[model samples]
Target: MASPLEEKTVARLVAAATAAPSMHNAQPWRFRFLTGERVVLLHADLERAMPRSDPDNRALHIGCGAALFNLRVASVHAGLAPRTRLVPEPEDPLLLAAVHLAGPAERAPDPDLARLYPAIRQRHTSRHPFADKDVPEDVRATLREAAAREGAELLFPGPWHADTVLELVRDAESRDVMDPAANEDLVRWTRLGPEADTAVDGVPEYAFGPRKRDGKAPVRDFTGRRPVADRGSTSFERTAHLALLSTPGDGPADWLRAGQALERVLLEATLADLATSLTSHALEDRDLRLLARDPGSGTGQVQMVLRLGYGPRGPATPRRPVADVLDVV
Candidate 1:
């Protein structure tokens, strides 16, 4: 039997978990609280998997990891410390974790982390052009520390490295434009028009930033096929800030850690009044992945590339209702 306080704590954790961002806002995760054992189990909802974009379920696992991190933070706020086990069982693929709770007195909540909780709901991927002002070096270092605390590495590209990444993104954009299969996959999730039904989760029309007529650094134009009218445009910074999130091993556990780190960095940036976006274009290709990896650095593997700067707030993407995701067992 569980105490009323325990039940209340679990409910609050679930609410916070749902606040995590997901690819295309799929929210592909499910949670169950086991009262007798005082544990919360996170499971990847395979039905919600993005097969085309995430063929191997890596992105799905990443999204679940983000949710798991949120659960931990929420647990802290609710006077508990969360102990997690990633993919606790090999036989049960859907069984992602069993979180054991430690009493609040056992640990003190991190002050910086507590500050970021408010920004969790406010962080949105800003796709529009960033202001010409550069991100301070110290702030970038702080963001790196946030990711490192979550078991990942954040790589800030130098001028040459940034150019390499930009070129890779351009290559990916060109390939995606020519590949019928890739185009179809993007088309499936991209909603057209402002009045389009918001039930399905994906990149909404309004969220797609205006296309660059002069063809500068490649931005994933979600509205490539479906043209929109009167879209506003702004001048993007010439020197873009790019960071790579990497882990040691390329497995389920590593993928989860990378996801958590990714969100932590994003939330930290949000609290600092900075805008961020992620582009996995180069990471999606094997050759480009090799180029992105630094042999000297012991970082596990690059999971995602993030762009950080000061820019307009991106339009909020839609999310599935709590009732649609939560199941009381």
Candidate 2:
């Protein structure tokens, strides 16, 4: 067994883990550090779940998986080797993962994972527009490698396939506009006016990015027809740099792997000086999600649609205090 670690050290690791992105910035995860075993437990906070938007809890698993990945990265950065097991307890569905943090004497830290530590806090979802420029082939290859490391595939769609995916996103958006029930989750999670200034979880009005003026990027406009002060309209890139992240399976374990792959890709993109945004609006609908898959192979379930380019990086959004999410026992 590994020696016990300081609670403050564990709290810092949990803080970095919580920095991972979620469906709507919900931060739907809790961490428990078992001092005796030197293990950290990641659990899903069902209260933070979205039923209408993500009825099956696929996105929930993905978000928690991202947190798990961050915990591993933070551990490596802090001279600990993290051994992670997803869904360790078959009986408990919500017990997402268990990570044993071993000291360097037991297992050496992964240098590659440690290199990504800087990007953890640097990586933010940029809802703003990206410049019209092609991401270099080398950078794309690097991103693909990052995803593959976590047992996922990252595919950059060609022009025709990109157009098909955009159409599906628009179709999903129109459906959201028509369905009042669909907007319920949006209203509850979006912070406007004074709430944006103090809210710890959920997407703030400022992070919504500008309303799409004349671009084809599938950036979600959180405001809809509602008005916000000083929020101006801006034109986004005509052709978005879109990458589809997919896994071989469609189960809870696969969702967790996809989440890890998603964050890995995001972190690598961040280090590459690329601003990233996620478009899951289309993936929210089961049929539209199926249509968003790679047209070439017609295999692998699509988990996320990532937009990458050079533009203004988004501001850091709020996160729940580490004290609120971490418990040491």
Candidate 3:
């Protein structure tokens, strides 16, 4: 039998898990460590769910899944083997996953996961403009492999497809501007002025990056109509480097898998010295999501659109304290 895990160790793991990214940095997840069972349960904090933007809770599941992936990486780094089960209990829909933390004696640590340990803390979303340069084919392959390991697909759209995805994102942006209801979640989740400095969660104004003076990138403008001090405008890349992450199905399970894959790819990209940012604008709506998929092979459901390049990495966003998001049982 594996030895009991120390409470501090569990806390450390949960801390690392919370570092995972979520839409607007909402960090919509809670952790429960069952001491007797030697398992950590990931739960969705539905209170943080963006009902106006994500009524189906798909983004919520994806955020929780990213947290779960971080837990696995943290466990591996701590010399533990994390055996994970997704949605183990059908009756408990909010219980996204249960990770059994087996000691090193029971199972060997995964080197792949262990190698990614450093990137966990180093990775940050770069919303600023990336250099107008190509991400070499080799680095792209590594990112694709990272997504595949988590049961998802990553594809770099050609010029035409990329243009289509960007247009869809613009359409989503227009819809948000006209639809007051759609911007409710954005208003709630964005931190402005003094609030940005002290808030424990949400996207801070400092991390909002510059307004796109000229660029095809689909970066979300968090400062919608609201004025922000010291915010400037700059030219982003004329030709944005966008990649699409997709799954075979469009269900809860698929969303979770896509989330894991999304983080994995992000971590890998960070390690490869590539600055990255995510664009879920187009994927927010079912209709636009379908249009974002590869027209040549319209098979999978597009879950995320990632922008990669060489540029300034965005500052680390705030996260809720571990005590606020974790429970022991």
In order, the Cα lDDT scores of the candidates are: 0.76, 0.93, 0.92
- Give the higher-lDDT candidate: 2 or 3: 2
Q: What TM-score against the true fold does each predicted structure earn?
A: 0.90, 0.99, 0.99
Per-residue lDDT over 1-329 for candidate 3, one digit per residue giving the tens place of the 0 to 100 score: 77788999999999999989999899999999999999999999988999988989988888888888999999999999999999999999999899999998888989899899899999999889888999999999999999999999999999999999999999999999899889999999999988989999999999999999997877999999999988999999998999999999988889999999999998899899999999888888998889998999989999999999999878999989999998998
Residue 214 error, candidate 3, Å:
0.6
Cα lDDT of model 2 by residue, 1-329, tens digit:
56789998999999999999998899999999999999999999999999999999999999999999999999999899999999999899889999999999998889999999999999999988899999999999999999999999999999999999999999998898798789888888899999999999999998988878898988988887779889998888998999999999999999999999999999999999999999888998888999988888999999999999999889999999999999899
lDDT of 3: 0.92
Number of backbone clashes in candidate 3: 0
Local error of candidate 3 at residue 123 (angstroms): 0.8
The candidate scoring highest on lDDT is 2
Query: After best superposition, candidate 3 residue 106: deviation in angstroms?
Result: 1.0
Q: How many pairs collide in each candidate, listed in order?
A: 3, 0, 0
